[model samples]
Target: MTRTILTEAGAQTAPSGDALWLSAADALRITGWELKPEGMCRGELCVPLPAGMAKDGQIDLAAFWGHIGAPLAHDAGGTVWSLGTAASERRQSLETLEAPDFTLPDLAGAAHSLSDLRGKKTLLVTWASW
Candidate 1:
């Protein structure tokens, strides 16, 4: 059977016959990381998996995510699963409530610093013509 796995990035279909485990390939596609001999790897980042996270070559989705402190939820029927942002991301957001200061050019090429508007209530709108 297939289950719908939802993440902040988007959703994807994953093979989940038991609704609790996902094949290595399916899990990799859904999570953007692959379980390897070294660990779970994405690009150059590798997070070592705790022992027993992978069994019979299938990953216990819930346990794997939980091990990394990522939040996950599943529907009552287990047909849909949602993966929340990593705990580290959430912690970073909460730690810094203020937007980072940056400089950007205006229509006429005049640069403006976000810090300059710190004392005033400002509404900034940005658009891209693409």
Candidate 2:
């Protein structure tokens, strides 16, 4: 049976499997990463993966994601998913003492990215109701 998976790329349809096995096409559409002979390639970036991760033309999403030292979480029923930044990228940001970039909507619902304010002194005040 096929189910709707909620990922960072939004909802995607995938068949049931032991791993989050998705077709090469679906993998690229959902994750923007493609399994190439040189490993997973996204544009000029490619990360080498282990052998046999792709079987019958499908790749294991969870395995590929974890291999890059990123975080992924799912509900108990596996219907929802969340992807987080990779450790390597986070480490790089920490090394540079730069704040992580993120996007948020302004008062007029205009979306803005922290990177848009790059090279400017910006103060970020956040609030959350626990």
Candidate 3:
């Protein structure tokens, strides 16, 4: 059986094993990272995994997530899990302190650019009835 993991990026299914381990490939698919000899790498970034986190070709998912300061939550039945954004990403967002520029349309269908509000005190509010 496989466990379904829900992440902010999307959902992925990882092979199930004991209580703590997940296949390296499955873990990578869910986390966008691979456990290399150097470390857990995604693109050009690599964060070294502590000793014993990887064993017998599988990763200790809980320990790996904890080491990177990413939170994980599972349902009571252990059939589903949620992985939160890594601490590094959150730290980078805080360091930059700049919101990504985006464009959205108004009720009349006129598009507005966030950059247009630069240097002005703007209060942007959005609501959904759902």
Candidate 4:
């Protein structure tokens, strides 16, 4: 599933199994934190950001954002930024509770239910091409 948060600045989209990147406006809109050419801010508080923001309005995101304290890096393209892994202090996985049963349609339009595998050990893994 895809999760998104719409803020006054813009829409921040974070797909499952993928990291999140927020523009200066996006970060301010969602978290009420503004990214100056210097770093992040919310009135008097200013965080000395990292070396992500070049001459342009881009940011390389410092190693602190919410509970996932990881930095966001930009490649040579400068178009796409990669949000690195959560801090070592975080859990290996963020899922802390079991989910409710849901059904998904197969390629052939057959419905598959999680409950169907109740008696077996089920491992669900996810990935993206990036």
Candidate number achieving the greatest lDDT relative to the actual structure: 1
lDDT of 1: 0.82
The lDDT values for all models are 0.82, 0.79, 0.81, 0.52
In candidate 2, what are the lDDT values of residues 61-90, reduced to their tens digit? 888888888898887776556666687877
For residues 42-84, what per-residue lDDT tens digits would candidate 3 score against the true structure?
A: 8998988888888877888888888878888888878688889
The TM-score leader among the candidates is 2
lDDT, residue 121, model 4: 84
- What ranking of all candidate models by TM-score puts the best one first? 2, 3, 1, 4
* True-vs-predicted CA distance for residue 40, candidate 4, Å: 0.7
Supply candidate 2's per-residue lDDT for 91: 85
Candidate 4 TM-score to native: 0.34
Assess candidate 1 and give its TM-score to the true structure: 0.65
What residue pairs clash in candidate 2, if any at all?
none
lDDT of 4 at 6: 40
